[model samples]
Target chain A: MKINTTNYEEYFLLYIDNELSTEQKTAVENFIEANPSYQKEFELLKQTFLTPEHIEFEDKVLLYRLEDMEAKLPSTFKQSLYRNEAKVIEGYFNTTLKRSIASVAAIVILIFGYNLMPTTGKQNIQNQLANNTGLPIIKNESSVSVSANSTQNRIAQNEVPKIAQNNTKPSKTLPSIAAEKADNTPPVVINESIANSAGQHVNNENEMRASPSANNTTVITAVNEKITSNETSIVAEAKEAFENINTDNPDRTIYIANMEIDGDKLRGFTRRIGAFIKRNKTEKEK
Target chain B: MTDKDFNNCVDAYSDGVYRFIVKNLGHEADAQDIVQSAFEKLWVNRAKVETEKAKSYLFTIAYHQMIDHIRKDKRNNTTDNFEEVKSNVNISANGELKQILLKAINELNPTQKSLVLLKDYEGYSYQEIGEIMDLSESQVKVYLHRARLILKEKLVHLEKMRA
Candidate 1:
């Protein structure tokens, strides 16, 4: 094949690099056969760029280096183990701290609740006694009895009765049975009527004491059956009057100063107050 | 990639990569270290790197590693007069020609040295060098030509100095 000698200079590097097409390669080969100088230049460039020593060194060193790199790489099982251990330790620390904090908070709450709870056992006992007592008056009686009984138990045998007397006698120090019996010697029916009359008299006295005329007057027959019974009758009459007044004016039972006002009156009063407040606020702004 | 696969890639490419690094760096110890480091990087990216392209990937790592070393050294002191060792150059005549050529390569711009090494010693085509260096093929070729001219000029000067 005839080769283009002039173009060989431009394509010489490509030819040496094995990058030229088959036809171009054949042309370069034929040209090299024709020109010894071109051939010499080719060999010189090749020698300059691609030394045998460097190529051989690269080949041998690369294989050895790669083997070393392979040996340095961690095995799959070791990597997996490392990752798993990390996760497990993280989970353990996170959960342990969380649980510990929760436990500590719960203990603190328990202690706070213990302090907030009622600590007075005596108060609790008194509450129970008051709850069990039929009357409010019996609560004090039970309180005294419990204190006396516990105190008597703590005393020595020789000094027990005297201590019991000192404790119990004070609580039972009201008028003796004989004195009370003597005071209550009146007939049962008379005593009941007296009590009823006394209650009515007390109520009438309280009402009269609050009146303007009471300052100039005196409660001269407070225990007198006639006046007490008379006051009782007056209360019954007043209560009947109030009942009749309430029934007559079912929707407006408020009677102030003989003036019967309904709920509408209060609402009107409130609205007037509110309007006055608004007017005052507007005036202050001005 | 599995450990076995990574090891296999290492076995296939470490020595060549190391020799290439040594040639460029001119230091046997740094070359060996850079080669090991390159393989380690390959091992790290084994999952992303395909076995078929592992050699190119390894060379790419070694190239970057060598550049990093140069940059690091430059930060410490001036590497402006530093020399490169051509992988394919013979060490005859007390390493004078190799030293001169390396000095010439170091004198070339960063892009020129990289382009020439990729093209000549690594045996990468102009297009392949461009892909690795993120430049156009024409740019790589231009830079490579400039580098070769510089080396030739430096060699002539060294020859004159010998005379």
Candidate 2:
């Protein structure tokens, strides 16, 4: 039987590999024998399939080198969860866990402190009002006390005697007195005290006492005048106090400096805490 | 694949991978690096690669890495010329045929050299070669046949020279 040479390349490969049956092989052989010019090409095609020489090396050495290469590979991938287990645990404790713990602690302390502290300014004003009404009068320098009612009665009845005792040197003005008071008093007292002292200029002490509203206006005008007159003296006293303050006490200096710095830091810290609380509250509301 | 299976894969496939790369690249150091990198990639993606398919996976990786190395070395002017590589092969006294074949193999392009090595040296089927080479089976067969023809022609020419 005649075989087609046109598509014989595939059959030729199968024939060379001995994949064809005996009859097919015989037919391919008959075809090749008949085609004399195709003989050299067929032999070359067979030679091409001949296994090429491999680089010779000791099998033991190659295997050993391959084992060495295997040893160099990482046991696991870098991004694999198994590989990064320790780091993830460490990072949780170091960053996320610690930060959350600290935040919770700060918020707790802020809320507790806020609940304990007084909320309104009215409490301080009420304390001053109580002192003005009937409390014991504490002398500024000596800390000696007299009843407020008695002090007022004595000032009303024996004003001349008190003036004589001081040899008519006008008493230190209210601004100076107010400046010396360690606990900050309201400015209203400064106006009232200065107006009372100006009673001599009006020559009408009973009239000053008669109408409270008129007395308040007169006190305001008198306080303004006193403030203008005493501005230079107040500045001079301030400069003297600043200059004469003893620098020998290092502990006191450090304490005062620390107090000033701590005051500013405390204010800033409180402001931040307040803002944080406000934000959380707003978020809760939303 | 579990770590143990991956390790088993390394033991099973490392030598074959090394031989394939070394034969293709003609540089033992680069072959070692490519082989290790291939195993490392297998370990990285072991979750995605089935244990049975690890051998193919490794060879595929090593083949691509070898190609990349060739391209990179080409750009860097570090690729060894065919003559330079031919001169470096240590031919035994009676190994003229081996020397001629090595020289002939070196003359083929990098891809053809790789195809011939995978098919003949590693005993991979045309389909396996195609999978590793990212070519169709027919394409692999054609390329392998063309590569073998070149080698045979060179070998015949050498034999004629000797005669």
Candidate 3:
């Protein structure tokens, strides 16, 4: 019954909970009454214990529903782990893996397509020459010979004789022709008589005539001097002649004789011609 | 524990976990998700967790998850206006003292609110709460005492206003 002043709170809580004996409760009540200020403190402590507990029935229902859902959830832990692994694989395929595969395919196609392009372009140029000239286009190792038919013979007389022939080796390939075109080199003219003979046999005969052993060596020397001296004028005249060719003239089969240009060089030449035509057309429009 | 034992743990401890989380967060959806995730973590380490200590393991996982969520919520400012929302709820009705007490409980910081819930609603001892919350028993006791005093003061003030 001797409630210590420092331990008053301990007794007060016990008194409110009815844990203290009847005598102890009476003594605690007397202590509070003696100190009137302690009465309000005691009442507040009692009210703290009197606070109501809030039970949310709706929350209980929701928890029960959640429990039901969790109970029905798949219990195969390993399978769930495997499903996550499968998701990783699927994600890789959707992103990085798919992009890598597509990139590889694109690179392969580009390389193969680039390699095949030159041969296809050569065939197209050959076909176009055959169609226009109506001459059987003879493809040699380093020369494309279009035999001057009756109509081309007249055009050949005027163009081929003015420019002198050179006894240069007959090793002119298409790539060399592209190099020449790139350098803007002067065009070389073959003899008009050989051009009129047009074929593999005539090319061989001309090769023999231009050889060092030939009896026409003086004629060949004189022709080479004229070609070297008049190169610039011949190039200009040839370019002008090419520009004046009436492409719309149905009767004219323009035979561009053995200018042994390869597919790539031919394509380059065609591109330059196309650009020239485009520039003229644009200029006229303006 | 086997898969069957883990399932049994889920049935046994899920409701307590949900109640503990929901009371602390006051977000039913987040509480359900946290409870489910805690059980999943237990199931992952079921071979290591003893059947008898499964409840403790589950509660520990949920407590850490709640701490992470609170930290994330703080970063996102999701709970910034919580006090404004609490102030708007009218708690002056004669029979609505329960609501007022809950609102006051919500006003506590996440740590204090969690301690109050584990101790009162889940009936966890200070030592058990310390193990779940990763605090020492003495720290749990001190924090729990402070939380109770705050709740007491709030309840007293509200009661006076009603009178």
Candidate 3 similarity to native, TM-score: 0.40
How do all models score by TM-score? 0.42, 0.44, 0.40
Q: lDDT per prediction?
A: 0.52, 0.56, 0.56
The DockQ values of the predictions, listed in order, are 0.21, 0.23, 0.11
Docking class of 1: incorrect
After superposing candidate 3 on the true structure, give the runs of residues whose Cα lies further than 4 Å from its correct spot. A1-3, A8-286, B79-95
lDDT (tens digit, per residue) of candidate 3 on A1-286: 3777797876775564444688898899899888787887787655433332333323333223232354454658746766433443332245465456556445444544554554455445434543533112223313444422321332333322111111022211211222222223233333333333344333543464445443444543443444435354544454455445442332222223653324443444445544554554586588
Which candidate do you rate higher for TM-score, 1 or 2?
Answer: 2
Arrange candidates by lDDT, highest first: which order?
Answer: 2, 3, 1
Off by over 4 Å in 1: A1-9, A29-47, A52-286, B78-107, B156-163
Q: What's the fnat for candidate 3, on a 0 to 1 scale?
A: 0.04
Considering DockQ, which of the candidate structures 1 and 2 is the better prediction for this target? 2
lDDT of 1 by residue, A1-286 (tens): 3456665544666665445799988878778887877786565444335332343234433433333444454587677666433443332235567456456445444543443343343335334434433222112434434433332222211222233233223222111111121233333432344344334434444454444443322332332333435344443443333233222222422444686545445544545544554554586588
Model 3, range B5-98, lDDT digits (tens) per residue?
7766666677778767766766666777888778778766777999999898989999999889878887987854445434533323355655
